[model samples]
Target: MSAVVRGLVARGAGQELTVEDVRLPRPDAGEVRVRIRAAGVCHSDLSMVNGTLAPPFPLVLGHEAAGVVVEVGDGVERVRVEDHVVLNWAPACRQCWFCRHDEPWLCASSGTPAVARGATADGAQLHVTLGLGALAQEVVVPQHAVIAVPPALPWAEAALLGCAVLTGVGAVNNTAAVKAGDSVAVIGLGGVGLAALTAARAAGAGPVIAVDVSPAKRELALAAGATDYLVSDDRLAKTIRELTEGRGVDHAFECVGRSATIRTAWRSARRGGQVIVVGMGAKDDEVGLSALDIFHSARTLRSSVYGSSDPDREVPELARAVLDGSLSLAPLITDRIPLDAAPAAFERMARGEGARSVVLFDE
Candidate 1:
C-alpha cells in the first residue's frame, strides 16, 4: 500500500536538497493518499532550504500542491478516492478555538505535522510538511487537509491555488476588503504580489500599482493587472501619490515580508487607508510603529495569514474562478520543469529570477 517515490530532502542548514528514494506512507485513520500531479515552488520551500524558516533537518519541504486522491483510510469521508484535491497546510481541527471562532485558517491545532511511518524505511521516520509534504509523486495527508475540487481543473493551476493565489487574492478580497474603484498599491512583485494585483483588478480596484526591484518582474506585474509599475527608487511614495491624485492608494499590500517593504506598504496608503501585510518574513523581524504616524496618519496596519480564507470554501471557489477565467493563472506559470530539475528551480526562485516554476510530476 505504498510506493517508493523521488523526493527532495534537505538534511540541514546550508545543505543542498537531495533527491532521494523515499517511502510513501499509507493513509492512517481519517487520512488519504494523494497522487501528486503538480507542486508549486513556493518561497517558503526556498526559505526552508536556505535556513530562513528553521525546521528539523532531513525533512520533506513542500506544501502547496494539487493531486488526485488514490486511496482513503478508515473513517475518512471528506473526499472519495479518485477525486482531485488541493493540499491545505492549515488543516482545521473543527473543535479547536480558532476553528470554532470562524477562523479555520488560523486553526489552533493546525500548524505542525506528525510523521506517519506505516513501516520504517532505511530506519528513518517519514515526516510530512504541515501534514502534507506533497513534493513527491505521492503524499498522505489528513482528511481535513484535502479540499476536493473538480477533476476538470488542471493540477498545475490548482497547485498554486493551494497557497500563493489563495494568500494573495484572499488578502484583497477577505482581509483588506478593497472596494470597487479603490486605489491600491502592492509592494513586491513576486507570485503573491502579482496575484494581489490581479485580484484587486478583478474586484474593480483602480490604478493598481506594483513595486519591485526587478524590471522583468515589473513587466510581469503589468500583465497580471497592475496599472502602473514602479522600480526601486526614491520618492516611491510620492510617485504613488501622484498617480492617485495626490492622495495615496486606499489599500496597500506588503508581499515582500521585509521590514522595509512593510514600511513602504504603510507609507503607500493614504491617510485613513489600510495596509495589509501578506508576506511571511522572519518571526523575529519587527516592523517599527511610530507614535506620531499612528495618531496623525489615520492609517491602519494589519498582518494577514493565508489570506484569511476558509480552505474548504475558498479553495473550490478560487478554482472555479480560474476555470471561468475570472482568475488568470496561465501567466503565473512562467516555467515548468520536470521533477529532476527541482534543484535548479529552487535556485531560480532563490535568485528571484522567475515568476513561478512548478515541478510537474505527471508527465
Candidate 2:
C-alpha cells in the first residue's frame, strides 16, 4: 500500500520547489521506511534547484538528513523499527571494484535506483535526489543507505553527520591524515570548512588558518577552533604563508568547489604539502594549471569524496565525539526553521547567511 505525504518537489529545471502531495510506497526487500526528523539544507540542494546538477525533473531534493525507522522490508536486518539513523547518500555496494580494493567511499555503484520511486498527485513520476530523497516527511531507502546512530544524538545535529561533518572531518582525519603539529588551512568557511577546522583542532594541528569571503563567518570559524582567519582575496595564499611562518600550510582544504578557490588551495599549501578538494563542482567548470607549475610544485592534489568515509564506521565515531564534548555540533547550526521554510533556507545559503540551516520536522 502507498501513503500520501507532503514533500517539496521541483517541477522542472530552475524552478522553485513546491510542497505537494506525494505517494510513498512501502519498503521493498532490503529497504526501510524512515520518518525524517531533520534535514540540512545544503548547497548541493540549491545547486539542484538551479540546475547545477542535471538531476531529473520533478525531483525531491535533500541528502543530509536524520530520522527514525518506522518499518523494515524483508531481508532488512541491519536496522530495526524505531532505530535512529543518518541517511547515507553514497551507499557502497560491497561487490564493487573500489569496494574490493578497500575504497568503499569511491564505490562504483554508490548511485543506484537511477529511476524515481514515488509519484505526484497527478501521477507524474518523482525523482529522488541521490537515491535518498529525504526532503519528504518520510523516505524509503535501501538498508545500506541508512546508518544507525546513537539514540542520544539530537536529530538536528545528527543530520550533519550525513554530509558536512562526514566530508569535512573525514578530509582531515581520513583523506589528508593530518598529523599532530601539522599546519592546516581551509578555504571557504561554510559548514564543511568549519568541520575541518574543528577536526584539525581536535587532532592537535597547530596554526589552523581559515579563509572565507564573508566577514560574518569569521567569529564562527574562530569559535569552531580556527587559530587564524583571513578574508578571501588575492593575498589569501600570501597571508596563509605568513601565518605558517612563510612556508604555507602543511595541508590545505578547498571546500568552496569553485575553480578559483581550488587554485587558491593549491597555492596555499607548502611545496610538498597536500591539497584536499572536498567540494563538488560542476562538470562544465574547469580549472587550469600550467605544466611547469604542476611539475615544479611537488604537492599532492586529491579529491575527498564523502571524506573517504565508510558511514557505518565513521558516523559512530563522530557521534561519540559529540557525546564527549571533543566535537561541537551545536555551533555549526546557525538557523533552525520548519520544513515549510526550507526554500527560504536555501536563499540564506545563497546569500552566505550562516553555517547551516536545518529544517526541524519536530517543530
Candidate 3:
C-alpha cells in the first residue's frame, strides 16, 4: 500500500524548495509511518540547499520533527500507533564498535547525507535527508529512528528536542561537562546557540555570554539566560575576555560551523578551557592552528556530533523536564507557521531574522 502526501522538495543546490506531491510507500518490516505534527526549519536543512552539504537532488529536506505513529510494520514493537515520538536522524547500531565503547553518537552506520526512499508524483526516484525526510504530512521511517515521548508534549517544542535542544543542551552537559559557576561563551545565536545559552543558565553557569553577528538578537539572548550579549566583530575575542575578568570563559562553544567562527571560539576560551564545536560545516573548510598555540594554550578542542547524545535514552528525560517546568522551550520558538510558509521561513533563517520557524501540520 502507498499514499501521496505534500512535502517540501529541493531539486538542487541554489534552488528554492517546492511543495509537491510525494509518493510514499508503506512501511517495510521494522519500520513505522508517522503523521508529522510539527517540524523545525533548521540550519542543517538549509545546508542541503546552500551547498554546505552535497545531498542528491529531488530530496526531501527535514530531520528535526515530532509526530504520532499511525502505522507500524511487522516486527516493529518499539513503538505503536498513536504514540507521540521525536525523530532521531542518527540512529545508532548497537553492534558497532563505537556503540560498544559507549559512544553511540559515533555510530559507524550513520551520517549519510541522503537516502533513497519514495518518489515524486511523476514517478521520479526521490531521496530523504538523513534517512528521514520529515518536512511532510507523513513519513515512513525505520522504527529505530523514532523515540516515543510523552503524549502531552507540545508538538512545536517537541520538534526542537530532536535537533536544536538535543544538540545544544548535549554539547553543554555531555561534551563540555559544564559545572555550576563555570563561565561560558556561546558564539552564534541561532536556534542551537540559543539553546546552548538556555542550557548554560539551567546548569547554573555564571556570566553566560552570547555572541552573534546580529545586533537584533540581544533581546533573544537575554531571554535565553545570557548575562551578556556581544555582537561579533574583529575584537570579539578581546571583548569576551574583558567580560570574563580578562581570563576568557571556561568553555567556548562554536555553533556557526565556519572556520572563522571556530577560530574566534578558540580565542574566547581560557588557556586550559574546553572548546566545543557544535556546528556542522563543509569538509573542505579547514581550521588552522599554530603548533605553538596548541602547546602553550593546553586547551581541549573537540567536535560534538549530534550533541554527543543518545536520543533513545535522553529524549524521554528531556520530555520529563518540560513536563515538570524545569526547562522552558518558549524562548526557542520564534514563529509557528503552516507547512506552505516553510520557504519564507527558510528565507528568514538565511537572513538571520529569527531563532526557529516551525512548520505546524493541522491535526
Where model 1 places Cα greater than 4 Å from the true spot, the runs are 113-121
lDDT of 1 by residue, 1-363 (tens): 577877777667788777777887677899888888999888877776665577765677689999989889999988998898999988778898888899987888776733544322464776656667777788877788899999889988999998989999999999999889999999887778878888999999999998887888866887899888998687888889999999899999998888888887788889999999998888778889799989999999888889999988999999898899888886687888788788888888778786778888963
lDDT of 2 by residue, 65-90 (tens): 99999999999999999999999999
Query: What C-alpha lDDT do the candidate models reach, one value each?
Result: 0.83, 0.88, 0.94
Question: For residues 1-363, could you state the per-residue lDDT of candidate 3 as single tens digits?
Answer: 798999999999999889999999999999999999999999999999998988998999899999999999999999999999999999999999999999999999986789999999989999999999999999999999999999999999899999999999999999999999999999988899999999999999998999998999999999999999999999999999999889989999999999999999999999999999999999899999999999999999999998899999999999899989988888889999998999999999999887999999998
Rank order (by TM-score, best first): 3, 2, 1
On lDDT, the candidate that comes out on top is 3
Clash pairs, candidate 3, are none
The local lDDT score (0 to 100) that residue 144 gets in candidate 1 is 88
Question: For model 3, what is the C-alpha lDDT against the true structure?
Answer: 0.94
Candidate number that wins on TM-score, 2 or 3: 3
Candidate 1 root-mean-square deviation in Å: 1.7
Per-candidate TM equals: 0.95, 0.97, 0.99
